[model samples]
Target chain A: MNQTIIQEVRETTPLIHHLTNQVVMNFSANGLLSFGAAPVMAKAEEETAEMAANANGLLLNIGTLTSQELPAMINAGKTANERGIPVVLDPVGVAATPFRTNAVKRILSDVQPTIIKGNAGELAHLVEIPWETKGVESVGDGNADEIALKVAETYQSAAIVTGKTDVICIGSEVVHNHTGHPILGKITGAGCLLGSILTACLTTNKSIEQQALTAVQFYGLAAEYAAERPDVNGPGTFLSHFIDALAYDPAKLERE
Target chain B: MNQTIIQEVRETTPLIHHLTNQVVMNFSANGLLSFGAAPVMAKAEEETAEMAANANGLLLNIGTLTSQELPAMINAGKTANERGIPVVLDPVGVAATPFRTNAVKRILSDVQPTIIKGNAGELAHLVEIPWETKGVESVGDGNADEIALKVAETYQSAAIVTGKTDVICIGSEVVHNHTGHPILGKITGAGCLLGSILTACLTTNKSIEQQALTAVQFYGLAAEYAAERPDVNGPGTFLSHFIDALAYDPAKLERE
Candidate 1:
């Protein structure tokens, strides 16, 4: 199922509209491009609705949510929801501050996301449960896996908790655990890009189960390939190779 | 004066706060680095004011303005103003659409920019005068030089109009006319990057006059060098070469 979706991603090349933070904008766009998706970063309230309605899928990221961007996200997400386009929400830093939490709540109220991807702490908070969170990193007590399932059930959306390993769940079912490279955390935008790649998968396939598994597998595989490159000069070099790996032929993954 | 500013840019390497669009974030960040400046893209309202206050300059670009980004821009711009840090505004597509124009006006009224950079049509519309604009390109009744001067005077800020030749103005002076290659337009983010480079120059130098000249001269020289590379296959190659040229030794600009 994973390989099939990867093949579809290569073939269809969906256009993904991202309303993301300024810090990760470029990386997200390039990451999407590498995975055979055309990325459009449109944040204006006026045009965002139009762009979202036209896109194959929409990813709403509040990593750098500002006052104006909040409205644009709501407008774009609403339009995407109305148009029957899949919406992926990355409530970046939601557990870190009140502003972020409120913004996430507002987005949730406005758009029924197909998937909500975040660290363990953010997910726990969004689901109104007590969990540990440390500066955008997931380091918490309680059953993160169980909490993820609860959040997914509560929101009626798939939940993704990314850390050393990524866990995706819906309701009581633990979907997939994708072991990605440790180096992925060293680079910025890894999580944001994952959200984008998931959008690509959602556009091509109907099953959330298949999309979640394939996205994690393909992303982890790409990171593995990047780690294998000669002279892996930390995050900078890893960032370049990660993109290259994503753009690399899917046949290469099979051979590996 | 220009030489003094260039030396200071190399020496100080001031951090610039960018609350900009997503399309050119990488190019802007890399360009600032190449020109010996630290670029921090902070759009989250939670941290934008802090970033702006700490940084030496602020650049607010609406190239991909989302509703969420507007508040961050306002927060950062207000903080930058209070801290006496120079702020540069690039009103991309201001003349082309009402959404863009209203945003530009709001930013202008809120921030009181130190410099306003755009093409002829953008500048014309910014000053409330009608002018023809075609998808980021401008071809109108007025001369580029005159339009640049007029806009500078109207804004009471330095205005830069880049085209076949880059024309910069402080009021009506038309201070610099930097002849540059046309191929620069083929690549995206050239103008967005110019704003970043200018922010670096302004933060390093004492006066905006010398900073403007150095910014235009250095950017033009880099473009000229990139245009000469034999392997310039397309826009992608051009972008890579542009970065390479920016990081190249300042001695390379001797001929141009």
Candidate 2:
């Protein structure tokens, strides 16, 4: 599934529009660019709708949402919906703030997202359950796979809950056991890059299940490959190597 | 001057607050980070003042400014002025749009800029001249070095004009004919990175002259080094190798 999706993504190289937090915008753009996708980040209220419509995929992230950016997200999401472009919602820190949660809820209502990618706690909170959010990090109530399945079922969308192991779910069919490295957390924008990667996959892979599973597995695999290098000592070096690996890897989608 | 500034920059590693455009924010941040400085990009209206006051240097760039971001720039600039934090203005694309020109004018009027950096046309436009702006790319008039010096004296600030040859002016004293690479323009955000690098220099190099000269020279040297690699086929590879060189180079500020 990963290899198939990678081949398709390399061939298609979709343009993805991201309305995300300031912290991860460049990394997400660079990551997508590295993965051979074009990224246009037009967050201004005036041009977001136009940008979204022209893009093959839309990614909405509420990591650091302000009152000013909310309307633009809704407008972009609506344009994406009208155009039948896939929208991936990254509900970053959804459980952390009322503003973020409300924004996520509103965006979800407006966009009718193709996928919702979040951590265990963020997913739990989105489904209206109590969860622990540890400063943009997540502490799970139980196993991530079970929670991922429940969230996917509840939202009626493909759910990706990423941790040490990534879990991808489409209704009842859950793809579990993705291998990634702990060093990924040290690198900023890792999750956001995954969301962009997922966007790239969903744009090219016709099968929804294949798209979600492949993106999750391949993203983890890339992280694993990057972390294996001894010189990739810290997050910054790891990030550089990871993007370099993703950009040049001939077998990007093949699970080793 | 270059050696003194590089030594100071590495020793001080100041926190720089940047109210810059989206196109160069990541590169600027990473350049500052590589030079051992902390870069805080708080562009929202609510936090710009606080962030600016807390930082050691403030960098304002109008390259990719939307109508919404102009106020934040002004707010940050004003705060930096009040706190005596060195404010460096990169009037990018100032001659390209009426909005950008007006914004740069407003900021200059209210806040005293420590250093003003741009290509010849941008500097000329900031001083209200009939300078030719060939799209966002400006080669400047033949007397760009003279133009930069005159602008620096007029504004009572250090002026930096960069191109194939870079120029730095501090009052009556001027440094001209610094060398760099032609391929620097192939990669976006090179100018913006220069601004951030100067901010890094300001933290350590006490004199504005050393800061301006060292930053431009170091960046040029790195770009020249990157150009030496035949493997740098495009902007992506060039960007990666440029960064890697910055991280690895022992004498980034060595004088020719």
Best by DockQ: 1
TM-scores of all candidate predictions against the true structure: 0.63, 0.66
Question: In candidate 2, what are the lDDT values of residues B97-212, reduced to their tens digit?
Answer: 88877888888888889999988888888776667778888865677767787888888999998877788889988887565777778878888888888877776636777677
Candidate 2, residue A157: the lDDT equals: 86
Going through the candidates in order, the fraction of native interface contacts each one reproduces equals: 0.27, 0.01
List the global CA lDDT of all models.
0.79, 0.77
| lDDT tens digits by residue: candidate 2, A99-204 | 5667778887777889999888988888766677543557566677777777778778888888877788888887775567876654456788899989988897
Off by over 4 Å in 2: A1-17, A21-58, A62-68, A74-191, A198-220, A223-256, B1-15, B26-42, B54-56, B96-99, B128-133, B140-146, B233-237, B252-256
Tell me how each candidate scores on DockQ against the true complex: 0.17, 0.06
Model 1 per-residue lDDT tens digits across residues A1-256: 3677877877877778888877787777767766777676766778778777767899998887887668889988998889999999999889988999999899998899998998878888888788777776667856668767887888899888777667889667786665579898888888888999998899975588889877877888888877777756788767766776776665675356
lDDT of 2 at A83: 90
- Each candidate's interface RMSD (Å, one decimal) is 5.2, 5.6
Off by over 4 Å in 1: A1-13, A44-47, A66-69, A141-144, A170-173, A253-256, B1-26, B32-61, B66-98, B101-191, B194-242, B249-256
Interface RMSD of 1: 5.2
